[model samples]
Target: AQSVTQPDARVTVSEGASLQLRCKYSYSGTPYLFWYVQYPRQGLQLLLKYYSGDPVVQGVNGFEAEFSKSNSSFHLRKASVHWSDSAVYFCVLSGNNYAQGLTFGLGTRVSVFP
Candidate 1:
């Protein structure tokens, strides 16, 4: 019954510009949310996560996201993006155990222009 949807298939942004990636989820109970970044030929790295407490969470490389219970959304934001930030961003969700594996969105490919 839990699922994720990333509306945008691809996003193009200029270097030093702000960026926002949309994510929406469907879950009945408490959900563990995550955003991962994967560079070319690289493994997925956790950018940020929202479990409980603060709705806003900061992540590596100046990235952050806010969780909204009402909208069922958790959108990633960056004040400034770099060319190196060009990678595939995936919005993921896990109910309890990481061992349970992950349910991921279609993924959003971010392209940072020079």
Candidate 2:
């Protein structure tokens, strides 16, 4: 089975500042990884995903994520953040195939101060 863990529960940063959210996943075999974000009163949206090939994948709204097998991590990063970026980010792990069930982390709440 695959599992995800987001170390930080909440992160506060000033608007326009660079931000990075940590995500750790545990899975023995190859797994499908994804980063999802949820805004206030909205459903979760896919940010980026890593399946094979490239270790880095670009996402919407200038967001990107890097997958590391050795470290068992898939961290999300944004060079500059906006107040609109404030939301709850989740690290999701689907098993070896996408059809399998998905396991999500507790999620990290990001707040951007203006």
| TM-score per candidate, chains pooled | 0.95, 0.95
lDDT of 2 at 17: 98
The prediction achieving the highest TM-score against the true structure is 1
Q: Write the per-residue lDDT of candidate 2 for residues 12-114, one digit (tens) a residue.
A: 9999999999999999898889999999999999998899998999999999999999999999999999999999999999885666678999999999999
lDDT of 1 by residue, 5-106 (tens): 999999999999999999999988899999999999999999999999999999999999999999999999999999999999999999865576899998
* Stretches > 4 Å off in candidate 2: 97-100
> On a 0 to 100 scale, what is the lDDT of residue 1 in model 2?
68
| Candidate-wise lDDT, in order | 0.95, 0.94
Locate the minimum summed-lDDT window of 10 residues in model 2.
94-103
Global Cα lDDT for candidate 1 = 0.95
Best by lDDT: 1
